[model samples]
Target: MRGLGRVLDRREEIEEIIESEHKRVLPKLAEYREKLKGKTAYITAGAAHGHAIIALLKELGIEVQGAAIFHHDPVYDNGDINSDVLSSTVKNYGDVKHYNVCNKQAYELVNILNRLKPDILIARHGGMVIWGAKLGIPTFLMEDEQFGFGYQGILNYAEKVLETFDNIEFTLNLAKHSTMPYTDLILGSSWESSLAKEIKADLLILSVPITYRLVLTCGYVGYNGGLRVAEDIYDRVLDTYR
Candidate 1:
């Protein structure tokens, strides 16, 4: 049957894709393991940027000792992440430092972090970030994902807040580009399919009273795109205490 043949083809394609990504991640994993061999790393999960950072760090074989996962949650039923998904996809080591609030395990994670006194804290999600601030430790807040329309209002607020925080990071969007000649200025990031945001595309930011702007970002894709910026700030956060 045509449907059957199509299904088989799709399956093979998926396998090929997985194989490619695995190859890409493997060497990077080795590199990370070498650098972060013994350091304690804490990470969060709530969105793609956070997810990628945590996953990549763990994939690189970092010594992720303690974690506080704010799983923005594709994992609904199982208190634990599902087996089908990549363990690194959600957080370092599948949120190995995951704390279940029902069991008051979240408290345990905080207590453990307090005693262990980790060198770096990489956090995502709003509430956990607030908590990280209180810790007075080196912390990196993962900026959230924003679709084109969603970015306007957010950017308006962020323009003010970004003034205060040293690092306001977001995952590069994985969306197709829009080609309309006009755009708005009140927003931020947008979404697409396939891989991620490419510099070639122009984004329109919209506002209420005809104040529109186009965001033309160059050299955008993968962790390297946004991550390079984060790493700089991460270094600064570390230096502040050290």
Candidate 2:
């Protein structure tokens, strides 16, 4: 587990990067805040990052009508839910609905939204974003790279690359019938490597479960590419807290 000082240090790095690269995102966030005035909002956040956004909304005077906070399952080992990390930030906001990320379901989300009847839905996950859109509710996604392309994503990509290589080797071996005597050994090695890679990939995914804390606030500070505009905004707005 990382210490709070480390977390705050990471937050500082994110703040610096936002200060340098994504200067416009903060202004855009402010603009959105202004636009959201008088509109009631329903927010669902995974990990501490979600609470930060809620804090920001409250600071900007937006009416946060309801909030759903999802913590990753304890067995997943992403990290223990440290309520203390966000408690101070969200104190006056009132009781926040809590759920486990593993238990999240589209139907349950919709049912909650239907009950809340907020003017807009703000969430950190893409599925929730899509759900909001489908229900004719305005949705805003607060995200960083960890949402899709973080540790788990890297493992997924590596697995695909290895699989592709194994497929190419298997095809080559099949094409050379004249060398059938040697094919058994080559094919066996290829198959074994492929199996090993698949197993390793699966294990990585299981151990490094795609939990909310994997890419919480300030996680985007060091990345240099992809979703430039959105990443810029996410990192910048998030950096203000530091």
Candidate 3:
């Protein structure tokens, strides 16, 4: 597990990456309706990921009630639920939800969660774990690169010169997040396990970004790639906390 110090050391760089981040979370789009239909979630913090998730949920049939955005400005697309942007440094998405909590503190965040009590809470930031735990909501932790990759990279180079890139795609990878079950993260990556012994949730949704990355990069092959990733995540989470 990477420590707080390690994570902090790369904080600025990570923030940049996460701010520019693009993660592929397609869950076998065919079953998307089945997986997300009738389900609801609260996407807190980080607009890009939140927007991505909002799209994902909508595709899957789940309703994205709203987001507790932590970027530059609150983007308002829906008339009802508003988004929260913490500071100017954090970037917001174009789909723009509403805005409200501008200068408020913990009360605003928890107050919103207390009101929503969403079925699932998806947070992409690697730093803030206490807030998620405090919300006492079933959380999904998204890790950037904790999972293993390289099952298909040919790394072909002529005279160390970069040649055309051809990545081998996996139809599915059942072992994507095998170690998650042993950790404390909801999406149980090492991110949430700093003082893991101090806090353990009844359930965790630990996700692996590596396998799914390949899936999306592979396009049509992503359908199978995503489902297999989910299966792997689900099985590991079940084994650890279920």
Candidate 4:
């Protein structure tokens, strides 16, 4: 069957990627492990993305202080019970703090961050960065879920964490003087008519916007997408600090 052939081909491709990425990423992670020694992190993202990043960080010797998933699904469409994100994460990483909350709950997230007080915060959605900024914790904003897909993805994640820590002073300075509203800003909405007027955060339009902006080419789904997202975030951080 053509479908079966395509599935087999995909499996082979993924196998090759994993093998190649392991060779490429392991040495880099060894270096990163030393640079990240004793640092703790808290992650807040969607189920799959959060799980992958947590796994990669654990491998790199970063302490995962806690994690918050936006939602949880007991089983996925494939009908495999073992594929559940929550169970798999716990099984793999062991008893790190976990929370299930929606993306809009800024108050609760802030409370949790205050309680955990991790050295860094890693997040994937809009508005989450501001809480870490407000709390004076350096935050790395993952543009999408594919950020931890392959070995390069793992390297990219490590690089971003190091960059976040490298620029901690800037984040602390911003927090000291930031007057941005404590509530979540509704991107591409009339509520936040002018994002510049509301906050000084970098804006990257990644989704179907309700505003006049149109996205025809840029995507964040696969291998190339992961690279693009990493580049965009890194460039933004450089632009901010330099």
Q: Give candidate 3 regions above 4 Å deviation.
A: 1-27, 73-104, 126-129, 143-242
- lDDT for model 4, on a 0 to 1 scale? 0.73
Cα RMSDs of all predictions? 23.5, 26.0, 23.2, 19.4
Q: Model 1 over residues 1-242: C-alpha lDDT tens digits?
A: 33454777776666666577667755644554565566556665544344455554554455566454444454554656553243455443565454322222444545555566665566555555433444444555555433211213323322322232344232112112222222122123343211112333223222223233243563335878567445533443344332
Better of 1 and 3 by TM-score: 1
Q: What overall lDDT goes with each candidate model? A: 0.44, 0.50, 0.44, 0.73
Model 1 misplaced regions, further than 4 Å: 1-8, 44-57, 69-112, 130-136, 143-242
Q: Pick the TM-score winner.
A: 4
- The number of clashing residue pairs in each candidate reads 18, 0, 12, 0
lDDT of 3 by residue, 19-104 (tens): 44323222233443554457666666555445555554444455666676565334554432344322321243234243332312
lDDT of 2 at 240: 36
| Shift of residue 57 alpha carbon in model 1, Å | 4.1
Instruction: Compute the lDDT of residue 68 as modeled in candidate 4.
Output: 82
Lowest summed lDDT window (length 10), candidate 3: 156-165
Question: Rank order by lDDT, top first?
Answer: 4, 2, 1, 3
Best of the candidates, lDDT: 4
